[model samples]
Target chain A: MKILVCIKQVPDLESRFKIAASGTWYAAEDLAWRLNEYDEYAVEEAVRLREASGEGELVVLSLGPERAGEAIRKALAMGADRGVHLLDPLSHDKDPRQIAGAIAEYARGEKFDVIFTGLQSQDRGSAQVGLLLAGLLALPAVTTIVAFSHEAGLVTVRRELEGGARAVVKVRLPALFTCQLGLNTPRYPTLPNIMKAKKKEVRTIAVTDLPQVAALVRTEKLAFPDKRGAGVVLEGATSEVADRLIAILKEKTTVLK
Target chain B: MKVLLVGEYRDGKILPSTYETVAFARKLGAAAALFLVADPSDLPRFAGKLYLAAAQQCGEYNPEGHLALLLQAVQAEEPDFIVFLHSAYGWDLAPRLALALDLPQISEVVALAEGAFVVPACNGKLRRTLRPLGQRAVLTLQSGAFNADGEPAGTPQVAPLTWAGSAVVELVGYEAASRGAVDLSRAEIIVSAGRGIGKPENLALIEGLATVLGGEVGASRPVVDAGWAPHERQVGSTGQTVAPKLYIACGISGAVQHLAGMKKSGFVVAINTDGDAPIGEVADVLVVADLKQFVPLLTGKLGGV
Candidate 1:
């Protein structure tokens, strides 16, 4: 019944982003960091599974800079037994293969029954790490799972596919799943739980100490997506705006006709 | 460069995205090959080498089996680049194949700039150009990024592949998403809500606007995930791709996933407080006003008109 949930710290989506000085990613300064929204569901699902079993260790893992420890602490506050932080100051520069390889290196000997990860991180949005990690570990994996159930060493998950389709899949123990949104409502950390999470053991492993995996892909440059076009912005009184919109809709589109 | 384009077969037909991948390869101007897990009799007119594997032997949507087949095809063809559509099938299998081959993999490539792949990050607010370190790599092209004009010309030398791998994951079956009674795809006009709508109760205003416009009510992913709207009414990459005649996006900031669903609409109007929202980029008309104040006025005026 042992479960491992991999989490990541991502900048809040609402944050105003600027191209970093390195020209390969967003600027680190003035960005508010938080647990990746999708990973929260992964952690919540893992905690619930551990609680349902009534006696299993739940571990949360994160690979990021020093600030990522905050995300691990948040997961611990939500009921994970412990945290493992793969500390890398330049974690943002690593590609999905290297990130997955580092996690695989750490989890190779853990022998957890099931591993959980978010469908993708908000920053990188590659959606490759979980499956890559599964491949590296030679474990069966499912992605974008919105529903999950485990019993008698068999795990069933319903994956959200394109166009809102769902694929029901099953795998034996030692499988991996990438949790999607709506899987579960993540519980907020209570004050007492937060205090207790402060005491939870978080084992930090320097990513340098792990077997180095060469990055297969390198970020050449980062830039704002080109604007499709300059839109005609309507301002002033709401009534005036509505009037102009209706007029344009009638003139420009067949729908109003 | 030699490129191998993998086709996705589902429900006894090759998906349209497969041809789009061909369009991508054509755009790359590389010598290309096609691979599919389908009978040769029904194969599309591909202009290059075609690798075929019987679907029965491969199993429906079997990752391990597909990986084995693809690996064999890659070995036989010795392609420099392997391409797949950034689809459910590709998203699941490409990384596995990449890791197995010990090559780099890039997903959801929207464009190619100076030979580097351009992909969206930070929810499409930023774009990153990625360069593969090695000559051999795997890539998944974003849906709708490339246009397939027609069936490719010329005869393809068909090569059959075999897979002898044992399956570790079982496909139980598929459950169609409970769509209830709503189907956003068929709607002529849609008024979609987003997080900027402020609260669940604000959906009534969105519905009102939809009703006045003689259209269906649609919503972005966050609105549906927040239980402000039904799943069937969702319009996005993971939800439903809609190309309605008129799409009035209310309070939707337009994440890439959301834009993918409705970017094909005949005309778009986005009403949000944030003028800089990504929705403005694609919108024909951007109304920078609080939806709470603007939607009611717009709906009332449109209904009266």
Candidate 2:
């Protein structure tokens, strides 16, 4: 059995985001990058599945620039057997279709039993690439999968829905599933595993070599959210603040009185 | 601009966001029309055109079949803009249809003004204003971003669409997210906590305040994902939608998903340390202070032990 997990490196969620001088994207200087939170779950699930099966090769895939290689190495350290880096210079801002097309083109011939990706990237948050890749590959696709069990060429999964709903889907082998949060707690790599992961091979593929796809959308402008007028900050001790809050709630809102 | 509105339905009821999506599409100066793949009985009558495609296999929500049906509608109507509510149906089918038709896609649009859209990025830390470079585009409106139009205009021109395609993915079954011990949807007053509450132990403060106010406790996705709250008590795009008469938001930063669920409450009170949190926009009263200090103080003020 073979499993393919797709991951992307994103600016750490806690980082202070500033637009670049060009005014098109995030400032690259001094920004810390880490595996997307959802993608981390995907990698963890892939590793767990491989370990459960006990005989499959788990390959991690990422489409990004040189820095993304570091994320791939982390996934490898987590237990993936190998990594495939789809190297591209414009990794910071590739159209979802363009990215999906490149990945589908590369994976078409691999005939992996399953593929896993995050529900969406934290940075772009488009949440479309996985479904697009599924469409391109003509494979069954499930999104926002929170739990699943696999056996004998069949995968049964529970996908999240609005209003705390879960849909149980049963798909045949060779399907793609997008992992959501709460799927599993990712494992931390030990020192020995981290050292061994450095020796694992990450095959690099040039983005130019993949199928040509044009970007359907373009970024027009980037701007911060409009800052509202100064809110009335109730000051003084906690007792005073509580008095003021009660007064405001009773006078301005229906919470009191 | 001519717009095609993709309507979503589940279990024989048209999702409420469909009407709001029509209003949003209309705001873009497009003559919007509703494209329904399922039964239209649940959809309120509109003044615009209504296109129906009764595909037998599409009775259930499967992205693959929905995409094929939508592509057929796009080809037949030749509209410049296709609008869908940014729910599960839109999230699933829009990308594929956009890719198949070679059209630009704008996802999770919060506000639209004069062909330009406001979308949040960096986990709602920043908002970007974007315009599609092409004349044609597919757009998904974030839920609760627009108000549903209730005024009647005129009778709509109902038409049937011809669709023929097969879905690559088969529909198996669906299980609704379990309702927790307390039904948030029916709660008259809800006290919700966000990451701002600081720690799991702090939830006791929220529970105490809710208890004193005779309301139920709710939480944001991060709080629930942290295991401090159950998934059923979570409110947002993935969780329950509630319209309690009064909602007290403690330390919630108001991500779009979280706002989608509670935005319609009759009255809102936001307590947070950050003055600029998006929750301020919708809040009736914004109290800028640490929830840790304010919640306990307020709970004590309410005479809670």
Candidate 3:
């Protein structure tokens, strides 16, 4: 089976975010950007499935500006055979529906037996695109998939449901699933493959050249949070600790109300 | 411009988050409107319009679908600003909508100012200011972000949204790898374990206390990644964001992402061998001890279920 894994480039979760003085957006002046933390599970799952079957190819896809090539290259080094980078100047600003639109249009013209993506992007974190993409493709869609199985052209997956419930369902080939973390510990790109990824090909396309997207229904101003007044720490022992803390807690959340 | 609180409903029923979103949205405006989108339902009773869409379930009390519909309505009937609670479906739906709409979106918004939205970023330690370049913005509100106006700020008015196709792709089936625990968010008191529990078998001790507390058991990424626990139980950036009234973390060093999800939790008590562990940094109370000995003693004292 051929596999296509979707990934996104985002600001590193550890770095501070700042809106530009102009107020257009977070100042990207010096912030670090990398593959979304969750997409790694998507890329990793594709690789693992390929390794387990030992007779398949993994093609990774991303939609973004020039630096997105770096993200795609990382996927290639992680064991994907090659990459396709959809170049959109505002890829960083594109909505999940629009982004999913581009991916679905491209997939319609490609040859992949299955598709995968992180359950959600760390930054944009809208986990909808994966399921929406499946809907567009008219394939079985599963959300928060932590386990999977593929055999004899049929696919089975488990979706995390509310209140500790789950729904295990199986669909045939050509399905889209959002991979949650712990589905696999994605491997970092190896040194040898890291060098090879530079030489390998990455297909880039213009966003305008792709399918047309509806007018963005909304716009956003990205901002970081204000600091919490220095946190209050309670000094105490183990047993009475719960009792004291419970008092403070009851004083805090609306859960008690 | 007035603040708009977006909500998801099916068959004319509103979820609790809708009320929560409305209550929160009212904070940013002198008066606010709570809007619901679905197949023309009983929205007149709510504070705003009832936008209709193709027949389907909006949310499972956690509606990514309803959020999509709400975004569509937000587009059709633009608001000065929109607010949503950052639950699982909200987290999955809101950010990209903000991105698609090119609107400035702040997720995990814990505080709001006239020109600035105070959000927890880089996890919880760092907070930054967001000034919307546009006329409006969308925010995924974190629990306990603000004190919602106690008094109703807006009168009820019905706004109608006609049916239409969703721009978002559809998800056919939501099958899980395994059945995990239900709504980890609603658990009022949470007993969470980390990789420090040593082994899956060790979870029995944690479960013992969880039973006593009448709460659910949550885990850190390591344990979930190790397959000792389901992904649903994992509480952190990659896992669920829980704002339980009382959070008891055992044998876990707090990573930024892990703290991002739970730090808003009302009161946190941490137990770890290293008294200076990162999780201990913000904990309301620190119990420095080996969980191995502590768990048995704690459970013995609390007694069995």
Maximum-lDDT candidate: 1
Model 1: lDDT to the true structure: 0.89
Clashing pairs for model 1 are none
Instruction: Provide DockQ values for all models, in the order shown.
Output: 0.73, 0.51, 0.18
TM-score of 3: 0.62
Q: What is the TM-score of each candidate against the true structure?
A: 0.96, 0.90, 0.62
Per-residue C-alpha lDDT of model 1 across residues B193-228, encoded as one tens digit per residue: 999888999999998988887899999998888888
Classify candidate 1 by CAPRI docking class. medium
**Regions of model 1 farther than 4 Å from truth:** A235-237, B39-41, B152-155
Q: What share of the true interface contacts does each candidate keep?
A: 0.84, 0.56, 0.17
Stretches of candidate 2 off by over 4 Å are A30-32, A190-192, A206-212, A228-243, B40-44, B55-57, B151-156, B162-167, B186-188, B197-199, B271-276, B284-294, B301-305
Winner on lDDT (1 vs 3): 1
**Per-residue lDDT of B106 in model 2:** 85
Give interface RMSD, every candidate, in order: 1.8, 2.8, 8.0
Name the candidate that leads on DockQ.
1
Better of 1 and 2 by TM-score: 1
- For the candidates in turn, chain A alone yields TM-scores of 0.94, 0.90, 0.83
TM-score (0 to 1) of chain B, per candidate? 0.94, 0.88, 0.65
- Candidates, ranked, TM-score: 1, 2, 3
lDDT of 2 by residue, A160-235 (tens): 7777677777788888899888887788989999999999999999999887888767776676776454435554
